[model samples]
Target: MLHTLPHAEADFRALVRKVTMPKPTTTRRLTTEAGAPIADNQNSATAGVGGPLLLQDQHLLEKLARFNRERIPERVVHARGSGAYGYFEVTDDVTGFTRADFLSAVGRRTDLFIRFSTVADNLGGPDAARDPRGFAVKFYTEEGNYDLVGNNTPVFFIKDPLKFPDFIHSQKRDPFTGKQEPDNVWDFWAHSPEATHQITWLMGDRGIPASYRHMNGYGSHTYQWTNAAGEAFFVKYHFKTNQGIRCLDAAQGAELSGKDPNSHQTDLLQSIERGVYPSWTLYVQIMPAAEAADYRFNPFDLTKVWPHADHPLQRVGRLVLDRNPDNVFAEVEQSAFSPNNFVPGIGPSPDKMLQGRLFAYADAHRYRLGVNHTQLPVNAPKATVADNYGRDGLMASNAYDRHAKNYEPNSYSGPAQSDQPLSAPLALTGHTGTHAAPAHAKDDDFFQAGELYRLMSEDEKNRLVANIAGGLAQVSRDDVVEKNLAHFHAADPEYGKRVEAAVHELRED
Candidate 1:
């Protein structure tokens, strides 16, 4: 400390140099699309100094053109999302219930990609918005890709898909004002009485989830699972978060949205990065196929839930998300999922909404991501090769054999049908027409919702009423407000009375 000798002085000088000097970097030659090395990259080609830019500047032109076409069309719903790579490990032997290869053995694992999204948001919307979260998982199994497209809530607003577009339109911004209108929202809900159960859920304490990791995911539609013996059972999937349920109130959600719009995305990414991976325990409620005919309420109704008392959940597997996407745009944004993407044993049910989605989801992907979207790495099957006769389209990378026959039933053995249907076919008797749902013993729309309201604690009920009134009071039409109140009244008398009083007080103020 007093004085430095010759060696000490040299050591100090070396340390200073090490701290101040730039780290050594390797030379990697930049190239054009054709792999030619670029001589000049700092400036664009010109006729002369400050004269005119040359059109032959391939690099400049290519950059501009690519930049111009950078963005693709956003999704109509669930546009704002975050995705992760994971593995779903079968924890229990479900071979007895389903012949699906992925769930065949207790220790079998299937690679998967999951995307969590806000239901009614744009690309730039805040992650903390009070909206239902889309919890879609694509499992790349040995047989094929099986997509479990679901949502955080166990039930939805409407049972029929015919009303889907109108319901979404009401929830979205008004055409004229470009703002979400309470009048339109409440009006639609008032008219759609079947929406009562889901409305109760949406206005309840769990509406605004604290984070994607803390919420449960449900296959809202009933699906069919066939055993190896060809016995079919109706099934509903539930993925309960291991992290536990956590939610935000109106004040907290608004505050988080303002402070960090991408809070959910950031949280997921950072959690994975820190090696604090999030996981969910998968459970299923199985119903005997024969029981659907007289299950108190329609088992296939998307707007209803199977009571845990009737069909207790059976433990199945666990999904652990351990890796974040390397490139969000290529892996997450461009990813596609479809309810129709089923393997050998798992298949669709007679659920009206589910039946509509089996066609609609795949068609939407074709329109948005092109017919060859399945060839993309994120959507592609990992354990099995796709050997179909599907040919070229935009950006087709020729993932198939070049000399193979293009059509089936040919002299040459192209890909042929498996001969086995995915599930046992239902015996159809009723005529195909625009008809109401088949009646059940307890088909009335309001009783389960009433039960749900009655199950809430005092504080939860208070918050639910306040939250509902905050929106209902802004509705311009008295008839719309009254009709919505009546639906609430049908659910629970005390629930409806409190909400009605709150709305009136707000309107008066």
Candidate 2:
């Protein structure tokens, strides 16, 4: 019964006219990276029509060689991400807190790029999975590329850097099973009670963010900010989204994983493309340098938070993402952020986690992107670098150090050290041998977690219990599950009881 409909002459002519229209012409010709012309790309060079290929085919050799080495190694953590170009504008004068040039004056703007990501997912994995999102910002400031690498949560699981590798390994897939085993995760958590606070937050409603635009971002570690008077203050950054906070329930997140794996990435790109920009108001919790020594909890502990009542937030600036990447891989993937990239007024604190990241991030970039990764356009600093010590490395694109006097302290007009004094030096008097982390007399890991649980609403509490039990139910070892539940019991008896009941019900089913 199927039949072809007759087309009108006008419609047919219009379609033909569109299809046969002359395309724009370009004078550029195809060439290799070395700029050699590729004359016969369709066929390989051969001794005869049907004979063996010739070795002198430079084009063929170059094409194959380049294609073979195209892929770079992925990050050990935070492998999957989406990034956008933006600016950070100082809305309120924060000269009292820090002398950082970007935050020097009201209404001043610094170009920046922000990358949002899932901490434990692979490059092609579902973006909606239950994992902490990495909220890192790289500010192309006048001094240099200052990077504020942080997470969406205000606190982290571990305070020390030594345990980071082991913790990450436990979260990732098991070597034998080739899948993330809950047994391994629970075992680690059960032993490290310091992780209790972060675990509670992770199991709560805000764990799976609705999108990168909806969740709040935090520079979790305590940092030092020096003012014009050279007085230092311990500060923490909080980027509260202008778009109201939103989250996907476990069911919604799981469903979207199957329906649209790249939901977050697509949402971010499309929103920017449509001119619906996303933004966050920057706030900092400043603690007097002297107060850090006498704080109730270890001020630099990544596992703890400075209570808002004690050290209140002060508005500083606004960050707006308005442009999407032209080429995702070239720009977004190549963009690198590190905690060590600090400005003149900003400096590192004694936070153990921050201390480790200062070294690890730069080392990882060197391994994945070669020694001259900073030479890439996406990572190159907007400000001029005066130093001439660095010379040649693999893929070295810039040669500012081409002058014969590449070495420092040379008489031949080489760059001289600045006369300005460096930031105040941190005082250290600890022993050289292995020692436990500095402890405040009243430190107890469960107190904060308990306080957080008591603050949650009834529905949020129920969801938290369900999320925790859901993962615990998958743990094959009953001992591991029981020990983890005990830790939860120490935090809150009701939380433990509810999760226990849920786990039992799941086991029965």
Candidate 3:
């Protein structure tokens, strides 16, 4: 009769049939966090085995206290992400462009870690959602750790940092209903015409990348690269994916979201494990420093891009993700990247968005990963570190300067600032006041958006219109829809008319 029962049910009956409960192994004992042996894990200390629990049970108290505080706060943005270990190899010498030690030689390799993420999602959000992706990289160079914090798109929605918080709030869940409101998103975009170009891209097929490996990466903001001779050049970094670009339309993305929400994360890890390493050829667009002052459009604008016809891409290096992280939490979740972490040759431009990020990124890391976050193995530079500072914080294990004086200019042989000039000084003339960005000679925000719409194929245009109309149809405010349509009409008449008609049809349905 016992044999006739299912295997799992028979096993449970066998256990219950025992004369007494089985004792735990004597060979191994469980310990507390302080490494003290625990006497009885199954029962708490008491006057008797069945009596009321004693108040002096330290083991039980410690276990309960520790269990109550185990989780850290998730990132405010780019919360859903995957990372991998890799090396960036210099394939072509960029000595003429920058004096950085890492890029001096053709075959030199720098250890690196890269993280890919969706912009406006939570930690457990669907990876196939339609949103701009974050492509951030950290290079442990001989000179210090250099972080290229960028997005997949070369251009962003807004030019200034002041609008960033408001823009993000619109994209995130509404405070009232705890759901993403299209009315809020369109209301914000309609008021800010500068967002037209990026909105166009977001509504197009590029919004949903097929996989992280297939999408291109960009150091979206213009940076300054100084050569050995002190000549500065405005440069932009591009990582052209070797796997070729692949995108999913709105329908396909929605289907995958329901079927496999982790499609991107699984694809990247399995690909590297199967020896199909993904690679990207690094390229840079170099512009003479003198030309920036007289450029037709604002060179520092984050909403615009430098046309390829004006300045061509120069091959510099290649980045290959060859290894997966050993521990996802230690390596990927704790990894930090900031624009403030620049090598000697590379520096920031006057772009307002970049300027705000220089401070914001590091500040966020400090809050999220503690003050000594850089000391973590994933973020620490591989080269020699001669840091001198007073520090005692959460997880401050490897203090670089133990016995030495933490103060500068001391009698002790403490490390001093490098005599080499960090960057060339630029002349400043404007007063410190809230003023609008100076307009360039031929600056027009709608021109590029129109050009992009005109460049798309017929099928792409149809899909783009359908995607925009579908999202816009959810918005309840008619005035907001009209304002959004006006911006599109300013960009291209056909683009606006198609979207308007489609949105109206959707409303009728």
Candidate 4:
């Protein structure tokens, strides 16, 4: 009784109503990657199809080799993803705010590649899982590759990097049983109450977004922006979807997940092919560096958000993803991004989470891919790159030093690091000490979760309560379920009452 039935029946019906799968068309023209007509694809160019296989056959070798290398190690997170190529167009004049070349001119267009992904799942996991979806974008700007590493939710589960690996482990397979553990999940979540804000969003309708297209994206970190006048401002990015925000109830997600694991992927690719391009309006909330001290909330906290009413969204640009990737493995899987690739105007803030990702992402790529991973076309900058060092590693096809000096600080006319004129040097004052996060007066982890619940429609409310009870009922300990309800109750008394009622009713059944 603790378990609720999967919503396959309801979700499939929705898919049927919204979009129909295109019928496959047969074709006679078969060709290889190199465009040679494949006359005998069913049978490789073996000695005779029955005799000893011939290594002399280059076509056969090519085909097998390509097949062998089809897969790369799936990312530890953000495993399931879909990609598209597009152009990001600046819609307003914000050159006074940041001198980043892509945003310097109102009409400037930068070629962009975006990947939408689900976190905490394997490559083949269902897209409808209750999880965070990554909204990472790679802007191939004239200066360099600019990566906006973001997620659907504006806030994250944790503010500290120390707890990240442990939190991920709880979401992953348990070591002892190699299956998800109810105890493991709650143990981590319960101990760190800061996760409440994000957990609420996850358990609500937003947890399972309708698809990548329906959900909005957020950079979700406080970043620093430098103007041409040598002044710095704290900035946060929000990508508001023009198509309108949408979501699936837990029942709808569970049902759709089992019926079609790749529903989100299909929804995106089909949307573009039909010329119904999904777009997001880019906005930034700018807080002058001088005013950071008096902000009500810890301006740098990843767990909190700046109220839009207080700091109005300033229109900067628009992003339209119009073309799907031609090859999934080559383009989508190999796409790498990192926060450290900032240009002249854009820089990092003191946000701990952003600080961690700035290093962790590039390092992850180095280990997962290689030092030469940037040479891959998907990750390469669109503008010409001039450099002296950073040469020669695995699959190093981008060419090596043509200069006499391979190291920096030499008198040779080799490329030297450029100094940023826009940035006034920051002064450091805090003592080197282990410190707890700055506390806000009304800041409890549960307030936002409660607010999200209060905004749900009557039916959405029922679905949310039911979903929580469904997952909670599976816990063997009644105390664990009670503790979770206590959290909901703290957020909103009615929310806790509803979830508690659902759990009790399910338990008796």
Off by over 4 Å in 4: 1-66, 401-404, 421-426
CA shift of 244, model 1, Å: 0.5
Model 3 lDDT per residue over 423-481, tens place: 54444687899877779986777878888899999999999999999888888999999
Q: Mind giving the per-residue lDDT tens digits that candidate 1 earns over 293-347?
A: 9899889998889999999999999999999999999899899999999998899
Q: Estimate each model's TM-score.
A: 0.94, 0.93, 0.92, 0.86
Superior candidate under TM-score, 1 versus 3: 1
Model 1 is weakest, by summed lDDT over 10 consecutive residues, at 1-10
The pairs that clash in candidate 3 are none
Of the candidates shown, which would achieve the greatest lDDT relative to the real structure? 1
lDDT of 2 by residue, 306-402 (tens): 8899888899999999999898888888878899988888999999899999999999999999888888888988765635477678987665645
Clashes of 1: 0
Query: Of models 1 and 4, which has the larger lDDT?
Result: 1
- CA lDDT scores, all candidates in order: 0.91, 0.88, 0.89, 0.83
Report each candidate's C-alpha RMSD, comma-separated, in the order given.
8.5, 7.9, 6.0, 12.5
Give the TM-score (vs. native) of candidate 1: 0.94
> Which candidate model has the greater TM-score, 1 or 4?
1
Model 1 stretches astray by more than 4 angstroms: 1-27
Sorting all predicted structures by lDDT, with the top scorer first, yields 1, 3, 2, 4
